[model samples]
Every structure is written in structure tokens, then in C-alpha cells.
Target: MGFRVRSPQDFWGGIVLIIIALIAIWASRDLAGMRGFAFGPGTAPRLFAGLLAFCGALVALVGLLQDGPKIGAYAIRGPLFIVAAILTFALAVRPLGLVFATYVTFLVSIMASKEMRLIESVIAAAAMTAFCVGLFTYLLGLPFQLWPPFMY
Candidate 1:
């Protein structure tokens, strides 16, 4: 945490959070009034907004008091094959549907694991995919396609 924020621009994260909090407050404003007087629709938003402003201000204050000279730059540098494997599930889902996506995601996730063996990967992927299909399709009845369906 070496980075020093000199201006609001440098500390733009808090601004974004504040804006989001404000919007949530505004959106929920008409629902109810303050918590103590729950008599009107404006109560809920006012109470929520007040809490949001409080937390946002607290975060901003902490940012201002922290040390300077940001040390490490953050990045995601996982293997390209790993990423491709994950994307494979997404690609398969539209054409192959939920059953395929679940199976592919399982396969990709197993391959993505650092120490996975090929045989174990296959078994684990199959088991996980089956469990997911059962839970989502049978138990939850989410209305997702189990097999590829004709699209117009």
C-alpha cells in the first residue's frame, strides 16, 4: 500500500463507491422514509442513504490518511490455456446448452487446477457436472435448456 493519492482523481475509487451508494439511495428513496418513522415510502431510502454516506466518508477518510508511494502493480497472469478452457464452457453453453456448459466448465476447472491428473480431472469433472445439472435443472427448475434447442 505504497501509493499516495494526491488528488481526488488519484482517489477515484471512493468517488465511484459514493456515486453508486447515492444512486442506490435515490432509487430506493420512494420506497419508504426513515427507519424510526416507517410511515412513508421515503423512509427506507433516507435511512439507507445516510448509512451509505457514512460508510463512504469513512473509506475516503482512511484513504486520505494512508501512506504514499504505491509499491506493487496488480495483474492477473494465469495460463492462456486455462483461460481458454474456461471460455470453452461459455462458448459451448449457447450451442450445446446447460448440460454441455456444466460439463465443459467442470472440465476446464479441473484442468485449471495446478496439480490435477488427467484421469482424476475427467472423473471429478463428470461428477461435478452431474451434480450441477441435477441441482439447477431438476431441483431448482431454472428453465435453462438441458440440450441444444433450435433458435430462431
Candidate 2:
């Protein structure tokens, strides 16, 4: 009813975000040795992580200053599923390659959406996968394996 989050869940959410941001910033700090130009791999993460951490801390401060809600009101569902899916994707990437992993992730996401029919979702995922694979592999010449030699 108000122009604000309805519960304390959001404040705690800010805390979680701050933790994630701190972790990213900490991880990136180890890459300080890569002192390259804007093209360095560490450059973007360092900047991004620092920004995230700063924003997260600011959110926490604002929550503290205001009569913010608490974390207990939030609902967390299917966290295990999300974590498992992420782990699965990481494990599958090298062997199944980018294209296949993309397809699989798309399909899993669509099915997990709980709003689409299985066949319809599969078709849509396949189309999107084809489009992405075509763009990255054929058009941009980004070298990534879609499937192993025998599977392709």
C-alpha cells in the first residue's frame, strides 16, 4: 500500500546482497597482479565487485536509518533446485560445451517456469538455443564446443 517494500524481508535481502558483494570484492582483490589496461580480465570484476559492495553497504545503511522490515517475512523456495541446476551447468560445461549447456539450461528454466507446456517450452528453448549458437559460433567465430565430436 506504500511506496516501499511491504516487509523486513527486503532489509535482510540487502544484507544477503552485501555479503555476496563482499565475497566478490574479496575474490577480485586476489587478481590485483593483472595490471593491464581496460581489457584486463580482472579490471571488470574489480570494478563491478567494488560497485556492488558499495551499493550493498549503502542499502544496509539506509535500512538501518529507516524503520525497515525484518528478514523472517521473506519466502525462499526452490533454493536447492537452483543450486543444483547451477552445479549441474558448471559440471556439464566442458564436456557438453556451451551450446549444449545453453540448450539444457534454457529447457530447464522453461520447464521450471511452471507456466508453459512441456512441448511448447522445448520448442521455444530449441529455437533460442539455435539462434544463440548460430550467432556466437558461426557469426562471431567464438570458439566453444556445443557437443563432443561423436555426439555432433
Candidate 3:
């Protein structure tokens, strides 16, 4: 019998999780671990990475055991928009500041929705911007600039 992935979602999800866990584990290799039973900087991250890898393997096993539906067409728009939104937020945060960056990110992410409404998106962006500014700057006292440096 030809081997096949019973559940495409579970199999692919497991693979992604495993990859992320491996990367995390590798990246945290330099961090110090337990010293005389006291947890060090790498302890928690290593533990979490191990757990992620275990969960991914479990998911893959379950996928292999179960007979599932065929894989459907992948939707690129949602993922693309979400990734773009995240990148935009990262790039804009230092230059445009938190409020504008958050607003722009929210606006860009809304484009992923098929039923996106302009007014709703704008309102959502504004609300998100306000919430981020208030939480990070005012409430948490993060010292993030509300506007661009040139605007100061």
C-alpha cells in the first residue's frame, strides 16, 4: 500500500511545530541551564521547546493513525496579509511610533477579510491604536513614542 498523510492539517501542523521547536532549542543552546538544581536562563525555554516537539510528534502520530479528509486548496491572502501586518508593525514601530504603527498594522490585516468594511476597519484600527498606546505607553509606562521622532 502506498503511504499517504491521513490528515494533511495535522501532519503539516506537526511539521511546522517541530521545526519551530527545533529552532527554539538551537537558538537557546548558548543560554545557561540548571546549576545545582537552580533553574537558569535556558531552563524554561528548553523545557517549552521539548514540550512543543513532543506535542508535534503526538499530533503527527494521531494524523498517521486516523483516516481523514483530503487536503484542500491553500489560501494565501490571509497568511500574506497577516505576515505583512506583522512586518509593517515591526518596521514602523521605531520610526512611526506605536500608535501609527498599530493603526497601520490593523488596517493592513483587515484586508485579509473578504467582508472587510472600510468604516469598520478604520474604527478597528483607531481602537487598536488607542488601546496599544494606552496600554504600552500610559498604563505600562513603556516610554514608547506616540508619534514619529521628527514630530516631537
Tell me the whole-model lDDT of each prediction, alpha carbons only.
Answer: 0.70, 0.71, 0.90
TM for every model, in the order presented, reads 0.51, 0.52, 0.59
Write the residue-wise lDDT of candidate 2 on 1-152 in tens digits: 34564435555667788789778877777564455454566677877877877777777667656776566432333454456567767887898887778777776655444475988877887898899989999999998887856686
In model 2, the worst 10-residue window by lDDT is 72-81
- The better candidate by lDDT, 2 or 3, is 3
Top-down lDDT ranking: 3, 2, 1
- Residue range 101-137, candidate 1, lDDT tens digits: 8777776666555677988877877888789888988
- Comparing candidate 2 with candidate 3, which one achieves the higher TM-score? 3
What TM-score, to 2 decimals, does candidate 1 have?
0.51
**Candidate numbers, best TM-score first, in rank order:** 3, 2, 1
Model 1: residues with Cα > 4 Å off, grouped in runs: 1-13, 29-38, 68-73, 77-96, 107-124, 131-145, 150-152
What is the per-residue lDDT of model 3 for residues 30-81, given as tens digits with 9 covering 90 to 100?
9999999899999999999999999999888777878766668889999999
Candidate 3: pairs in clash: none
